[model samples]
Target chain A: MLDKALSGSSRYWTWVIALMAIIGIGFVFWVQQMIEGLTITGLSRDVTWGLYIAQLTFFVGVAASAVMVVLPYYLHDYKEFGKLTILGEFLAIPAVIMCMAFVFVDMGQPIRIVNVFLHPSPTSPMFWDTVALFGYLVLNVVIAYVTFGAEKKGIAPPKWIKPIIILSIPWAVSIHTVTAFLYSGLPGRGFWLTAIMAPRFLASAFAGGPAILILLVLLVRKLTKFDPGLKPIFKLAEIVTYAMLVNVFFVLMEIFTVFYSQIPGHMDHFTFLYVGLDGNTTLVPWMWTSTILAAVALFLLLVPKLRRNEKVLPVACGSVIVSIWIDKGLGLMTGGFVPTPTHHVVSYVPTLPEIMITLMVYGVGALILTVLYKIAITEREIIEQVK
Target chain B: MAKSTRRGFLKLAGVAAVGMGAKPVYDAFARRSAPEQPTPPAEALTAKRWAMVVDTRKCLREHGCTDCITTCHLVHNVPDFGNPKDEVKWVWKEQFEHGFPEQHNEFMSDDLRHKDVLLLCNHCDNPPCVRVCPTQATWKREADGIVMMDMHRCIGCRYCMAACPYGSRSFNWRDPRTHIAKIDEGFPTRTRGVVEKCNFCAERLVRGEIPACVEACKAKALAFGDLEDPESEVRDLLSRHFNIRRKPGLGTQPEVYYIV
Candidate 1:
């Protein structure tokens, strides 16, 4: 059984080698980031947090969304997702790891990150964020371990594990909700201060996260003989559609409040993103593209015919993922800074060194994910041999 | 000779003289225990909350008050960036319209074009920055009601920078000492990547000295005192004249009030 699982064409090795090369280039870039400090990034006083944080914020949601399928399938005994639930759990391990990696790279003193625990600041949202992140990481690992352990034993999971699984559903929601509070609770930043921000964050996470999972499932089918079936994928996509609708609705509410009230503080940020405030048009194209893509993707997902087609489904999911990434990751940070409180135009452009560092962090996350999944797959093969 | 010395001492010591000489010292020592006795009621102890009232109208547009900003920043080891791109300021002066955009009067003249206002952490009664700080790095002192930042605990997240309406907070982007040739002999420069802001010269306040900025103000335009004390200089000044605060409607109730 182990030999059969290991028997793959040379193409798999080629792909692995190629990924390693890309990762190597990214490492060189990270070295430059360390030497130059954050000045190498496009971030400035106005836009204090940029792509790194935005990606960090978005990915936390993606990691938490894994429970959307896991809870209903496992605790509820929905056998439709029995074969695919492990894949979702495995996917969460990487996403959560990546979320943490992105945050570490964004820190000025990555070495002193342990100070967060050594000298905890109870008032800081960041402290809470750290607590939530580490908690979710532990929960994911434990859940995966217990489930995989039961699989190896060829028996139902222990009764105690059931309570733990049930508890994780809301724990999953809390991780993303706390992440949203990190932004929305900020009082002065008009773009992020809405009460609806947390709900919107969960919605987008549910939409983008499940979409990525569906795409990954499709890739697995094309590459290997494993077929998890389309039933679970369609069911997950249906959930994704509703989440996307809610996400878009909250965004529209944000727009309406800003425009209708015409409060200069709130309007200024929107104008900067949409209408090019004070001749700073850098973010205009990106914002508009995200808005259009999100609309199109939502429409496609809502249509039964389009969503049912495997070909169209993947494209729609990819589009929504990219759209939300741009909107939440880049647009949110850039827009927050325009017409700065001092009314100064401080532009941020990600320097080459900054981009390289970002790429390096991405490569590191990918590396961790690759190794973990490989170990899990290898373990399964060993178990099959024993059987 | 002994009899003469005794006679001299007797002449030197008079009962009335001794009593006069020791009276004040005895009184002072007796009063020393007075503070130990709890006599004041709750109402008397509740002095008015400390606040500031700045007269923006009296501002002469001269940069003399920059001494206040410089002294405060120097003492706090604030990084001085000749380049605006890397500029990090715990305190600075802003032009009039920038500081009070809504205070446009029809009679305002061009000569006041560059009229500047000293800007620092408002130390608001209801500070949003304090509310948003995840780590409680920024906190309000119940004693004097000054909002302060604890640099060591700051995670360099800069959420306070985003949450401040006054744009008073600054982020240390690089090593603060990198730009300076010699560290000021006394004050240590900050580490890179943490948020720094006007602590209202809290260290100086602790030492029974006024904030450096207030001390350096040549025009004596900036004043610092307990607003709770009605007879205190700041309270007296506020009662005597009309003063304004930056973004009053934001409901932050800034301690750094200004008059225009």
Candidate 2:
């Protein structure tokens, strides 16, 4: 099946080569970061975590979103998702890889990552997050391999894989829950210290992940011989709509609790993120943009006619991804850090090297996605030709 | 032939895994078998639970005094990055409001409100930093309540930094070797990508000497002693003075106390 990826048109090769070039440049900067330590990034004493951690948080949601498709298809016997389930799993492969990569890049001592396993502390949420992510990655890889292989052979997947697929459903939820636990369970950081964190994470993940999948599937339709019918795409759009609505509702709940109660500890972070705390207003514009985009996305997705419109559907999905990306990936991390534990407001902006390294991680994800997607499409094309 | 070869390979792999696994098991057994160093040497300052009491009245008596911070940094070989962003602090001076954000008093005495209070690691009984450290790189000492950091073992994830409600821990964001004015020959300087903070001078206490900051303070603002010993100075200060712990509401049970 990998051989299918090796033979592609000039256009496919151009995209693949472009991703490789970006990856190469990013790798060079990563080596520089290792040499300079975390000082090369925007991370400081007050704002300890920045871009890498935010990206890791966002991608964890994206990786866990694979269950959205997997659960519906495997458990409910949703025939519409039968052709699309593999796409979801394959999308997860790169997303998880990107998640893991973001973690690796974020570490101050990347070489010492083995310490987490060698001297594991079960009490730590990070330890559990690492375990959950690794397990989720393996589950997806095995399921995708076995099921896709069976499809290629024109036979059913082996009986042994059923239990693994069932196990993956709960396992997917665990990964994002553990990731949320990393932030939410901390003694300080009022922005993250909420019971709603894990639920909010899942809601945004379900919204953002499938939204990304819709865009990818649309791209696949245009580029490949395989046309994953409108039924699954529209179904995914509906999921994105509801998830986005819930995500917005969760944010509103948080806002109401924070503003109405007027707890300075909790309100300070929200104020710092949405408005400016003290004189620091760097994140104000970005936060408002994300808020506006979320509103725009919700409006487009909620209207049935607009959602069904081919052009509008992609726009809504794109808005959802970008909005949630900024909300979770940028705002969430900074909000937790700023108005530091001591009430000092410090702003963080990712340096050139840091942003480059981030782009590089995305490039690696795109490259893996392109190859895996190429193989899936090629197999579908072969099946279509046979029919 | 294939089946026999496959079985042989599995057997080889099993043997290799056992060989790799034996050292840690042996090390664990060796540790359990060895005599425990349960008691400190007679000359050493032993503590059942270590604690510190900072007299802010005495601490900020002199204008712009940084004796404690200066002595601590010099003794610990803590680098002066000259910039706040990459600054590594062991002990530092912060205003009363900033030091204890939870104790927000708008109409406090002008002198108390304006004065700089000394802040360092509280070494909490229920230390969130220790609990959150994935590698067990940081832990609360069994004999003493001191939260210890094994810089060598830390992967520098900074989970401890976020978890520390007091903003005590500092990550070596850049190579610290470049910035230190003079190396403290006795102390081990840390590499970049590791977290470091005041260890309550555990090294000095083991050598029968008090913490450098406590020793250097002319005003006698900082008192360190065994909290378990009722006769100790820290106990005496706590009994006499109206003392408060930072963020007492969080239930971290900070060993460090402050007298306003």
Candidate 3:
């Protein structure tokens, strides 16, 4: 399988090289952050978490999205998705890796990462997040490897893989739930302290995560001799549209509750995000862009003509990814800190090093993803495309 | 990297999430069964529970005295970073509205509303920072209830800072040693990345001394003593004045009392 990764076209090799170059640059910037401390980033006492934690939260959603394909195929016996499940599973591998990597770069003491395992406190939500995420990563790796190995050797996946597949269903739910618990469990952060936070995370994950998988499968179909079929792609698009509608509905519910209740603590974060607190609307433009993009994405996905058209479907998927990316990636983690513990409205803007470190992690994810998909595609050649 | 039979690997994974999760899950349950927190060292147990009461009337806010702030910061090796964004303050004055947003009112008496009240770690009986720490890097001592930080153990997660409702915790944003104008020889300077806060002068308390802030108070506003002891100065002061704890409704049981 790895040998297959090595045997790529010049174009593929060029892409791999570009990602490698970025990984190197990212390493240097990470080292600089280490030497200089977290002060190199725009993070302050008020906005403690900045870009890295936001990326961690976003990728957790991506990792959980793999369950969408796994659920329909394994539980419901959706045969069109039979060939597509592995594609989704493989996508999760790099996403989880990047999730942990983002945490590594964000840490003030990356050296003490061993302390998490050295003294694991089950009482802590973060400890459970580690367990859930690491567990899911290993589950995906084993499931994808064993199943793909079986297919390569021209045999059925062993009977034991069935129950493990079932276990993955709940395990996938836990990953994002635990991530949400990181914020939701905190006492004073009104922005995140809501019962609906876990559901909101899962809803957005289902929407944006599968949309990304659809894009990847489509790319693989165009680039390789394999075609996972149009039927599965359309079905995935349908799941995304429904989940995205739920995600937007959930956000609206949150907005209605906050604005209606008129609780100052609850309203403080939204005001800071959307309108800026005390005339310091630092995030107002970014928040508005995300809101508008989400609406445009919902419009593109909801319209039957635009959704059904293969040309326009990819654009809708991109919008889903971008819109959710901004919502979760830009505002979600940092926004909670506004109206800080002391009720101050200081803002955070990720410095260049922080942005570079973020881009570097993405590059690392891309490289891992390229290799994994290449291995899977080589085995999956000559698949029949359903009408 | 070694190949195993698919069945063998699947067996291991089921064991991994549930089997490995067994001890910690059970330990969590066991810890829940016990009402008390992990016991502190024997020395802490010998001392009566320490607490403080600050009388705003005697704090000399009108004179703009920073004696308590300067004494504490200098002794604890707190840096003088000119950058407010990266400031590392253990104790400082914050306005009433910012410090007590839950008690916000549009109009109030000028003295109580306008003055910058001294703020520090409340050292709550139910410390949220202690509960949320993953590495047990921070914990409330069972004896005196001083929330202590094991700086070596902290991974710079800053989750404690988020959990603390009072904004009591501060991270060393830079190599804090670099910003210290003159590093105090006695106190160990904190390495960058770990969280730090007022340990209620736990070291000084151990040496049969009061907190630096209490000692440096020219107005005799800061009173430190065992809250458990009826004869203690803080207890006597709290009995006389209708003092309040910040965000008392949160039920953190903040030991620091303020007499407005």
lDDT of each: 0.75, 0.91, 0.87
What local lDDT does model 2 show for residue A135? 92
Candidates sorted by TM-score, best first: 2, 3, 1
Which residue pairs come into collision in candidate 2?
none
Query: Tens digit of lDDT per residue, candidate 3, span A1-387?
Result: 778899879999999999999988988998898998998899888888889999899899999999999999999999999889999999899999999999888788889886776676777898889889899999999899888888877899999988999999999999999999999988788898898999999999999999999899889888888887888999999999999999999999999999999988889999998998998898899889888888888898899888888888899999899889889977897679988877988878999999999999999999999999988887566233323
Regions of candidate 3 where Cα sits further than 4 Å from its true position:
A382-387, B1-48
Q: Chain A TM-scores, all candidates?
A: 0.93, 0.99, 0.97
User: Against the true structure, candidate 2 has what lDDT?
Assistant: 0.91
Two-way TM-score contest, 2 vs 3, winner: 2
Residue ranges of candidate 2 with Cα displaced over 4 Å: B1-40
| CAPRI tier of model 3 | acceptable
Docking class of 1: incorrect
Flag regions of model 1 displaced more than 4 Å. Answer: A1-36, A375-387, B1-52, B62-65, B101-114
DockQ of each: 0.19, 0.48, 0.38
State the TM-score, rounded to 2 decimals, of chain A in model 3: 0.97
DockQ of 1: 0.19
- Residue B234, candidate 2: C-alpha displacement in angstroms: 0.8
